[model samples]
Target: MTERISDFAAIAGRYALRQPLRIELEETGMNNTTRMIYAGEERYVLRVYDNHRDREIAGTEHAILSELQRADLSFRVPAPVSNRDGATITEAPDGKLAAVFGYIAGQRPSPESGAHVEGLGRAAGELTLALAALNPDARLAPAYKPYYDFENTHAAMNEASVKTLCESSPKLAEQAAKAASLLETRRRLTALTERFKELPQQWIHGDIVFANALADGDAIAGLLDFEFCAVDARAMEPAVVLAEFPGEDDALAMNRMRRFCRGYGSKAGLGADEIRLLPDLMQLRLMDVWLHFAGRLAEGLDPERVWLRETERVSFACGWIDRHRRQLDVLFAAMAERQAAI
Candidate 1:
């Protein structure tokens, strides 16, 4: 292996120039392991990518970071550490790619922080707007990629190879089959894609959940994680945010939706069709999660894991499907009506 935690000390010892005072690992991130090394009064964030991530992806992330830094947006992005040759990337002992960022002093926000939510929305909106402004014709290396057509709900569920992975486990067998069925239901809603005719395409932060953002009270302190960044429908960005937020009522959700839309519209306006499709996009988000849960269950993940580790998860997903089924129909009808109106 090229990048293991044990070698981190030696790597830092070579780079810090000055003696490091303390180094500690942060455990929150799932895809990459992060460590904070304090060299005297200054702090730096060391990020180690997973083995599955290739060098090209690392270079792509560097390009995205460089773009965001130059965009001069109203948020913090981790700065890459330049080597003795002023290169941003350095290979670790475990054969993994490593980069460093100046640590932003802030804490990850909780679901309850309204100010944080607003700030996050604003930051994301700004980033989306900036990315949208960039010409699609810009020259990029082979590693730089735009996010596109990643809505894998149907394909993942229907894959025969994926099914085979679950067949040995009875619990997963049922869940995988259910997941495939749900995906079919979602497939029936393909007409919604036409709504995107009026919706603009832009670069989007694919994962805008709370965990990936940092806040100081209601202010967005930093936006992190560009691994899933890609080009996609502009509305898809807000849809992703709304999908992750926790709210029990339509009123609260609508409020959040309005905040997000208003922020984005203040810059780039949304068409009537795009507005109508927002609710359906939110539902699509929910369906995505359920299908993912089913896929996990099929993959022999604990029948009951975390909050969803129970037989009831299946029933809950089904209940959500039944309740939202009519809403989806209405939403699709609204989309058609908007198309007619436009």
Candidate 2:
């Protein structure tokens, strides 16, 4: 890590900083190489693009954050700290695109913390409301491709990938078969694409998993990591957050989802069509995860031994979601109604 830190000395030099800059590697997401930098009394985050694809998206995220800062959002979001040359993104000696941001202080929430869950939901709602005011075309520097796009979903579920995924594990194979059947019987693929097209599109923080959110007691102190941000169907913002709610228990998970939807609806109220499509959107989210993990297993990339556990989680969640579809629809509908009345 120290060796990698040294490579960014030139990039760090571009920033107007106090003497004796200290760099420490941050162990977080798999996508980016993040470092915490201390320059005298001030702290900041330096992120180096790990993949080529992310390099293209960096400018859009910086622009989006800049816009969010101007909005005076209630929660803390990363503010781009431009270098001495006034460039938010600087090319490193190694050719990786790097950017600096003012550090936000908070801890990642524990799965068992109820306050954290509610706080996350509230923060998500507030963030969505704030983002809704921004026009995607005005803020995004380079166009972004959404990970949750129905076209991507179709490609992931194509026959070849499905076969490979099913062949990787017997347990997953059964689940894959079920998922494929559900896709057809539910008319999920066509319905989602059509509905998504009809719904309003907006710039969204596409990845709002727990790791990406920071909490202070019962409040969300910071919303971190906007690498997956994009302009997409508005419902996807809340759907992604709800899908990633931390828990292994089905009842608890459903309760958490209900709380999240309620929180979101309170601020950025869902439309009648969006409310009706909520259940399917969530199912799409789960199916997306299912395909992602299954693809990883098929590719034999379980270096961390997390794929099996993730696969099990996705499989069970999909089945559970299918069984309780009617209940989820009712819950979301009620939330929308309450919001409308308010």
Candidate 3:
């Protein structure tokens, strides 16, 4: 892997270039390249956008973070660092959008701790309330589409596309055939399209999985990676989070989900309608992953291991969610009752 440090040299020049600069590349984040920069006593993260490579989108995220930094939240949100020019955004040598954020103090959370899972849910709830309070430009929302548009957003992810992918290699055929599950998810979400509009809409941190939620002790302290933030169904916030905890099977994850919903409800209450749609919204989140991974595999950007895991994830989670619909409704209703909003 090319360090590409030299490519970022121009952008890095904007910040205080302390002697013997040290930049370490991170191993995570599929859509963006991240580097940790140590400048004297201060540590910061430099992210180069690979998903859209659009400066406006980066600006939108920075704007959102700026507003969130001032919001009435208990935890921390990443604040973009301004350069010498009093600007948060700068372009790298490759013309990709890049920005530096003061490194938040925390570690990746583990699912073993029920408090941690619950804390992440609480963080999700807090963030949901914060995003709902923001009144940014209406244009900032349209660029980032909701997860419900899984099919159109990824035009080539249809059944025929996956069939072509399956025929491409004998080894991929079995795993690749699972794309049908995504098609099914889209169908379900499609049937509820009108109802979704009737519920509510707001700016949301569309991706709130463990990788993006940082933990200080047993509770989530900071939220990272707003690159996927967008306007979507209000419930998409928690659904995005719940979709990530489908451990081994559904049993372990449901226990965690219970605690999560409790913690979340304590901060922000869910409406009766949102509660009813939680299962489908969670399934929507899964198919969104499916579409993303399938899009990557089709483009030759990733191997089958990448897409197969997502396909298998969708299959397991959606199946389990379908089997436990009544249980989900009950759990969400309990969550709404526990909310501080009520």
Candidate 4:
């Protein structure tokens, strides 16, 4: 087993003049391994990316944070700490990619808390509004698309890796086909990007799962992790918010969904069409999740640590499709309402 903290400290010591007095790893995030490092009076976050690609990804994250901060957005993001050479990237003892962030203090809201639900919604809404305020023409690399890419998701599931899952479990195949068909319609609609009225697109945090957020009381204390940030549809953020919740019942999931939309509307303001597209977008997001984990498994990566309840993920996906089928119709209805309202 890899000792995460000691690994982090060893990485930190190489970059900073003083080694951390203590390094505590936060184990909740799905992708990156995070550690809270206490060095002198300041607290910093040490993160190791799951993929060891080039340092350009890190640079993109750094740029996104700077832009968000510069734009004076409504939340907190990691601010990279510069070393003596005024550079954020530092070679660790283990020679893996590493960077540190200023730590902001806050607690994640319990899943059962109504306040937590509202906070999650509001934070997402505010982020969407803030992001929309930026220049849509802003340039960003394409690596950020996989998480929110509706088209790529359609391709992934029908492709070889995930198709094997469908073949292994006939029920899974049936459920996947139904889900994929709905997503296909959404994909076709989204492709006419020029035809649909374009909302202002700017830098968006590609991944906003539960762990990326922090809350104190009913308000978001901080919004951390921008490693997957890129320029994309304004709709992607709220779509992700809907995808994160794994409630046992559609009622509870809808409750959370409603709260999230209301909160986002508080800041960003959602139209009827946006609300309608959300359900399709939500399904699109789930398809992405399936492909994401499937891609990992196909690549021979162990998913024991990735899914919170590993064995149940497939069942949950199937259940979600079954329960939300009615809601899918509702989404289309909402879209029509949006067109009329507009």
RMSD per model, one decimal: 5.2, 2.9, 2.1, 4.8
Q: Give Cα distance to truth, residue 300, candidate 1, Å.
A: 6.1
Q: Sorted on lDDT, highest at the top, how do the candidates line up?
A: 3, 2, 4, 1
lDDT of 4: 0.62
Give the clash count for each candidate: 14, 0, 0, 2
Model 4: lowest-lDDT 10 consecutive positions: 303-312
TM-score of each: 0.76, 0.88, 0.93, 0.77
Predicted candidate 3 versus true structure: per-residue lDDT over 91-141, tens digit per residue: 788878889898888988877889889898888889988888866575465
Candidate 1 residue 270 Cα shift, in angstroms, is 2.3
Indicate the worst ten consecutive residues by lDDT in candidate 1. 141-150
Q: Please give the lDDT score at residue 57 for candidate 4.
A: 73
lDDT of 2 by residue, 62-140 (tens): 8888888877566899999888988898888788889889988888975567777767777777888888887756446
In the range 1-342, model 4's lDDT, one tens digit per residue, is 365556776677756545436777565366666777777787788877767646777776776666667655556767888865677876664667778888877887655777777677677766766666555333335445533454554454444544465455544455565444534544554564443235435667766766777777666778887777767666767777666665677677666665655565555655555555555455555656655665565465744344223324534654575578677456434434543454
Off by over 4 Å in 4: 1-10, 14-20, 26-28, 133-142, 146-157, 165-200, 303-342
Q: Report the number of the highest-TM-score candidate.
A: 3
Q: Rate the local accuracy (lDDT) of all candidates.
A: 0.61, 0.73, 0.80, 0.62
* True-vs-predicted CA distance for residue 282, candidate 1, Å: 2.9
Which one wins on lDDT? 3
Weakest ten-residue segment in model 3 by summed lDDT:
134-143
